[model samples]
Target: MAKLLFGSLAWFSFPSFADNKPLNSPVDYLSVLLSLVVVIALVFMLGYIMRRFNVTQQGGGQMKVVGSMALGTRERILVIQVGEEQHMLGVTAQNINHLAKLDSPLEVAQPSGDNFKDKLTQLMQGQKGKTHD
Candidate 1:
């Protein structure tokens, strides 16, 4: 009775204790191929959906700010304006700081005396202090 109970427990634990089969079987290979095809098809479908939604640009070449990085203890922000978007990345102290100042750029000054980048930074920092979205 003890041997029977132990055998029953062992069987329950080792459910896959059946015939030994090669992992690299034709069925497995076919399944892998099918999965790869499905993934590729899904990727194509996503691209199509993005195009339909206008999330991605249609034309090949558009003015895009490649990289913009900030540095220093002051967290002096460096922003790069692309076609219609801006990017803010992080930079090390070793990186050179080149301020691109456009003279007479703004026709009307901001009431807060801060540019777009400064306002964005302030907003982002404020978000860090509070939990509410």
Candidate 2:
């Protein structure tokens, strides 16, 4: 009786083992591809929804980044305009320091006579001269 019971259990388990075949059908591959595409689209949709709702964004007010300059590898200078006032801030990897609050917002000067590359080269050269002096 024990042998008969074990045989019946083995017979049921055999079909389960046989069902574990590698995915060899085009339909199986298509289903996997479709699932991957769906997951990627869902992630993108979630990011878009969060951005639309300003979920991870800072300062929900009317403050805007007017300009930014990199001072060093880990340091930056930011000019932020809030209403009619502009605030200059020195931001490092360790801390954010308030540099100044301007009474009147500074206007961005338009470059003249040269392209961006020429202006950048001139600026770099000027920095080198200043360092040498």
lDDT of 2 by residue, 38-126 (tens): 87999999999875654644454788777888888789999998887899999999999999998778885455737556699999888
lDDT of each: 0.53, 0.76
Distance from true location, Cα of 108 in model 1, Å: 20
Worst 10 residues of 1 by lDDT: 12-21
Model 1, 1-133: lDDT tens per residue?
9878766756433222223344456666676577679879999999998755546332335543344333445454545444445444444555535455433332322257354556998899998999965
- The reply for model 1, stretches above 4 Å from the true place, is 1-22, 57-133
Kindly report which residue stretches of model 2 are placed more than 4 angstroms away from their true locations once superposed: 1-61, 108-133
Root-mean-square deviation of every model = 17.0, 20.6
Number of clashes recorded per candidate: 0, 0
Candidate 2 similarity to native, TM-score: 0.37
Clashing pairs in 1: none
